[model samples]
Target chain A: MSPTSSLQPLERVRVAVDCMGGDHGPSVTLPACRAFLASHPNAEVLLVGTEESLRPAAGWSRCTLVPASEVIEMDDAVEVALRRKRDSSMRVAIAQLKADDEGHAAADVSVSAGNTGALMAVARYVLKTFAGIDRPAIAALLPNARGGFTKVLDLGANVDCTAEHLLQFAVMGSALVSALDGKDEPSVGLLNIGEEAIKGSETIKRAGELLRAAAAAGQLNFHGNVEGNDIFKGTTDLVVCDGFVGNVALKTSEGLAGMLTQMIKQEFSRTPMSKLAALVALPVLNRFKARVDHRRYSGGALLGLRGLVFKAHGSSDAFAFERALERAYDAARNRLLDRVHDRIRDTPAVLPTAPDEPAAAHAA
Target chain B: MSPTSSLQPLERVRVAVDCMGGDHGPSVTLPACRAFLASHPNAEVLLVGTEESLRPAAGWSRCTLVPASEVIEMDDAVEVALRRKRDSSMRVAIAQLKADDEGHAAADVSVSAGNTGALMAVARYVLKTFAGIDRPAIAALLPNARGGFTKVLDLGANVDCTAEHLLQFAVMGSALVSALDGKDEPSVGLLNIGEEAIKGSETIKRAGELLRAAAAAGQLNFHGNVEGNDIFKGTTDLVVCDGFVGNVALKTSEGLAGMLTQMIKQEFSRTPMSKLAALVALPVLNRFKARVDHRRYSGGALLGLRGLVFKAHGSSDAFAFERALERAYDAARNRLLDRVHDRIRDTPAVLPTAPDEPAAAHAA
Candidate 1:
C-alpha cells in the first residue's frame, strides 16, 4: 500500500480488464488485481464477464463487476469481434468503457490478454477509429544494443498491407517514441532485405519513396531502408513492415530468446568450476536477467485506436499480469488516448516542416 | 595426406573454380585454390577466369588455367548469365563441368562465390536440370543443438514455390543428408509458424499436405510442422521452406551472431576482473569460437544440378575461402555428386521400411 505513499500521488486512473482472459484465468488475475490495487490504492478496476465467472475473481475491493454472458473461444473467427463475443469478457469490458456517460469516453483505458485478433477487431469496431488512422497497430519494444528498440508494426493484425499503411504506421510509431521515449523527433527505419536506399520488396521500395518524402518534409526522421539484420542494432527508433514479416521477425526474436537461454544453461552446466563461477556471478547474471525481462515491459499498446487498448501475452505468467495492470494505470495517467488523438488530428498533410518555420503551420 | 596413401589410388575428382567470383576475388580465391589442391594432392583443378587476373594473386600454383574473357560484376542481373557474361568466370566454370571433351566433366565439380541469382541461372543453363528435377536448389547447413545440425534448402532460389518443388527439395535434401551427415533417412520438418500438425502460410500448408502423402508412400521422413521458435530445438534433421522466409531466417541468424558476440565483448569489459577471466580462457575461447564459426561451413552445394555447383560466401576472407575450397574438394573426392545422382535415380519410390512407420501417416 506504500506505493501511493512511496511516490507522488496523481489523479486516479480507471482501467477496465478482461478478467476472463488468459490461460490461468481468475487464479492469476485475481491475485494480480489485489496486488495492483494495494499498490495504487486510488485506481479503479472493472472486472468484466459473467457475474458467476467473475465473483471469485472480485475478491479485491478496488474492483467493480461489469457483468456479461459471453465467452469467446480462442479459435473463433475475427468476425466474432463485430458480433460481440456473446459471452466474452473483452466485449463486456469495452461496453463498460463505452457507457461512461460520466465523461468516460476520453478518460479510461482497456486491457486484454484474450484472442489478439478479437481484441483488435472489437476495439476498432466499438472504440471506433482514431481520426486519420486507417487501422490499429501492435508495436513491441525490444532490448536494443544502442539503447531502445525501434517499433515494428502491423505486428500481425493485418496480413495484406498497402504502402500507405506503412506510412501511417511510421507516423503513429514516431508519435509514440516522441511521447514515451522523450525524443522530440525519433528516426524511423523501413524494414527491407538491404540497407541501401534502393532495396527490398516492390512494396517496401515504394514505401521508401513516401517515407523519404515525408522525412524531407520533416513529418518523420526517416533513416532510410534497414535490413532485418539491423533491427536489434538500434539503427532507428521505428521499423515499418507488413504484418506477415513483422510477426515472423517478432516471433523469431522471442524464440531466439528461449533458445539462447537454454543454450546458456547447458553451457554453464558443462563444468563444475564454471557452475561455481556462475554462482559467484549471480548478481551480474541477475542484472542481465532484469535487462531482458519481457514481463517487466508487459503489454504492448494497440495504437491508432480511439480508446486505449493494451494486449498482454496470452501466455503471460503472474508477474506479467501484474505489470499489465501497472501499464494500464500508466497509460490512463498519461492521457495516452487524448495524446494519440491530438497528434494524429492536428498534424498537417504536409507532415514535417523546415527549420525556423512557424509552429502554426500545423493548421495548414 | 596419409589417408590418401591408404586409398586404392582411385582416380581423383576434378573441379572447376570461379576465380573471379566473390568480394575478394584473386586476393582470397587464389590462395584457397592452392591450399585445396595441396590438401588433396591427386585432385585436378581447372581454375576458370582471365589468366592476367590470376597471375598476380598469391599462391597460384597447382591449378590448371581454363581462360575466361568476361568477369560478371556482383550487381549484374540474371540476364547476364544468358548473354554478356557468357565467358565470365561463373559461366565458364559451369561450362567446364558440362563438357565431356574437357576430360574433367566425367567426374568433376564446379564452384563459385558469385551473384547467387546469376549462379543459379548459369548452373541451370550450363549443367541443365537433372532427370526428375525441374530446378536446382540452394542448400545451407545451420547449427542445431544436436551435433551435425540440420541441412536447410531453397535458401532463396525460388521466391514462389509450388508443393511439388518443396517435395522434391525434401527428396534432394534427404540424399544430401545421407551424403554429408551419413544419415540414411533424415526426418524432414516442414517449417511454419507453429509446431502443430496444422499451421503456416498457404504455401507451407499445401507443402505439408504433399509431404504427408510422400512420407506415407515412404519417399522421405516427414516430421510434421515446426514452429519458427523451435527451429534449433532439434525437432527434426532437415527443415524445408520456400526461398523468402528461409532467406530472412538465415540472414537474421547471421546478424544475431554479430550482435551477440559484440554484446558479450562489452559485457566482459565491464570490469578488470572480468577482463582477466576472459584472458585466462583464451584457449577455451578459441575452441568456442571455432565451434560457432560460420566460415568453417561457408560453402553450400546446389543440389539437383546435372553437375556439381558449390556456392561460396562472397564476403569470405582468406580462411573462409580455404574452407570453401576444402568443402569443394571433399565433395568431389568423396564422390558426393555421383552419390546424389544414384540416390535420386535409384532410391525406390517406396523408401526402405524405417523405424518410424507411423510418422509419415500422422504428419499431414
Candidate 2:
C-alpha cells in the first residue's frame, strides 16, 4: 500500500482507456467503462478517442473525454503505427501516462485493446524503458491447479533472448507478482525441458546459472528448473522463458481448451437421453466451465516501461474488457511501478547495461 | 500399400517387444502383446527380456522368447544404457530390426516403453541415420479437431536445430504422414509464432525459404507458416518445429488437459445433488472422455534411422501399449521406411550433407 493511501483515503485511481481500439471499439469499451465505474467507488476514467466515438460516455459520472483524431487498426504494421499514425487513440491514451511538469502523470495507468505489435511499439516509443532495462516484456497470469495464477513473462514480446535478458525478465516478473498478489517473496522458476540444471538449450543453461547467482545473493527467490507441466502444477509463483517458447505454450493451451469445450457440447447434444442429462448436470457443467474460462484472465501487463500499461485481448467482449480495466486499476492502486524499481535496484549484479541494439527495433 | 504386400498375402508383421521396459514391466506388456495378437491375426511377437520374465509367455502361440540378461531402469542415464547395459532388453529388442547375414531382417519393427533419452541414444548408436540425414528425430501423433491425428516430429530428439535440420524434419514428417494416413501429398506446416513469412527468428525465416523452395519443386506440399493453435485446429497434416519448442507445446497441452479433467471430476463429486447428476451424465461424459483420451495415441516413431523403432510411454498401461503395437504394425505394413527414403531422394536440394557435426551428440 502507498504511504499516503491511508492518509488521503479519497485518492481515486485514474485509468486512461483507448475507446477506438479492439474489434468492437466503443461498443465494448463504453459498456465496460460504465460497469467499472459502478463497481469501483473510488475510480475515474479518461475516455480517449475521437469526438464522435466518445459521445456515448460524455458527461457520465467520474468520466472525461480526451479527443484524438486517428485510430490504429488491428492489422496496422508497427512502422505505420510509429511513423504514420502519430495521433492514434492508442498513442494518445499511452501519452496520458507521461509525467507533466509538476511530476504528476495525467493518469495513473493506461489500458488498450489493440494490435500487440503496434501497442508495444507505441508504448516503448512514448514511455521509454527503466534504466538498465534494454527491452520491455509482456507478462500475464495463467491459472494453476492451486486455483491461483502462475505469472509468465515474455509472452510474445522478444522472440530471441540472451541469458542476461532472461535474468531481467525474472526480476520484472517477480516485482509484478509481488505487487499484484501482495506476496512479499514470490518463487521464480526458469522454464526448461527438465528439472535438472543441465537441461534445455545453451541459453537456458546459462540463464539457470544467472538465476542461481541471483538467488545466492538473496535478491531473488529462485527455485530450480521446471518443465512445462510444472507451470500448471504450481511448482512456483512465476515462470520465465524466451518469448518464442512462451508464446507457443500459451497458444497451445488455448487451442486444447477450445477443442475440449467444443467436444463437450457435441457429446451432450448427441441424443435425447444425453440432452436430458445435460439439463440435470447444467449447474455442475457451468461451474466447471467458469473455472477454466479464459475470459476471466484477459489482461497482459507490459512490464519494464517507465509508465504502467495493460493490453487486453483484441477480441475481448464487454465482460472481459471490464476485467482488463480492473487489472490495470489494481496494478496502479498497488504501486507496481515502485515495486519494479525496487526489484531492479536490489538485483544489480544480474541487471546489466544494453549489450547490443534494443529488440524493440525488430517489432516491425 | 507396398506392391509385394498384396502379392505375398500371407506375409505377417513381425514385432520385437521389450517386455520389461515400462513401469508395469511384463504385467502391462504381456497382456498388451496378448491383446494385440488376438486382434491382429497376421502378426508375430518376439518377446525380449530376462529368462524369468519371458517364462510366463513361453507356451503362448506365435510368441518367441529372446533372452536378455539385464534391465534398463527408467532412471538410467544414456551412458549407462549405451556403454554398460549392452545386454539389456531394450537394446536386444531394437537389435531384432537389424538385417541378418542372409539379407533378411529378424523382425520387421521394434517397440519399447523405456526412457526416451536412453532409447534415442541407444537406437541412434546402433541403427545410425540414413546417408544424408544427420540426426534422428522423435515423431509422435496428436489428436486434432478434424477427428484424426497430426504427426509432429523432433519431439525431444534434437534440441538445437539449424535451417537445414528443420528442412530435414519437414521431409521426414511428410513421409511419415504420407505412409500412415495414405495421403499422396500431406500438407507440411512449419510451426511459428505468426503466419507471415517474415515473422519469427532468423533460423525460422531461413527454414521457410528452404521449405518454399522445396514446395516449388514439387517435393513437398508446403502449407507455409502456421501458429501454435493450428496444431489442434488441424490446419495441416504435419507440424514441424525444433525439439525445444515442440516439447514445451506438447507438455503444456498435457498439463492443461489434466488440470481441466481433475476440475470436472471435483465439480461432479462436490455434493449429493451433483453426484446424482453425474450418474445421469455418465454416458455422455464417457463419450467425451473417449474422444480426447491420450492413450489411443501413445506410440512415437524414431524417424530418420536405418531401422524401424517405436517408443511407447514409460507409464503406459495395457490398453495404451496395445495402441503403440498397432501403430508400429501399421507403419511396417505401409512401408514407412521406403516412403522416407523416397522423400529424401526427391528433395535433394534442401537435404544437405551433415552440417558441421550431427546434433545427436547434444542429446546426452
Highest-scoring model, DockQ:
2
> Which residue pairs in model 1 clash with each other?
A69-A87, A70-A86, A70-A87, A70-A88, A71-A87, A71-A88, A150-A237, A218-A352, A219-A352
Give residue B151's error in model 2 in angstroms: 1.1
Against the native complex, each candidate's DockQ, computed on alpha carbons, is 0.25, 0.76
Considering only chain A, what is the TM-score of each predicted structure?
Answer: 0.84, 0.93
User: What TM-score against the true fold does each predicted structure earn?
Assistant: 0.79, 0.94
Candidate 1 chain B, which ten residues in sequence have the lowest lDDT sum? B355-364
lDDT of each: 0.68, 0.86
Best by TM-score: 2
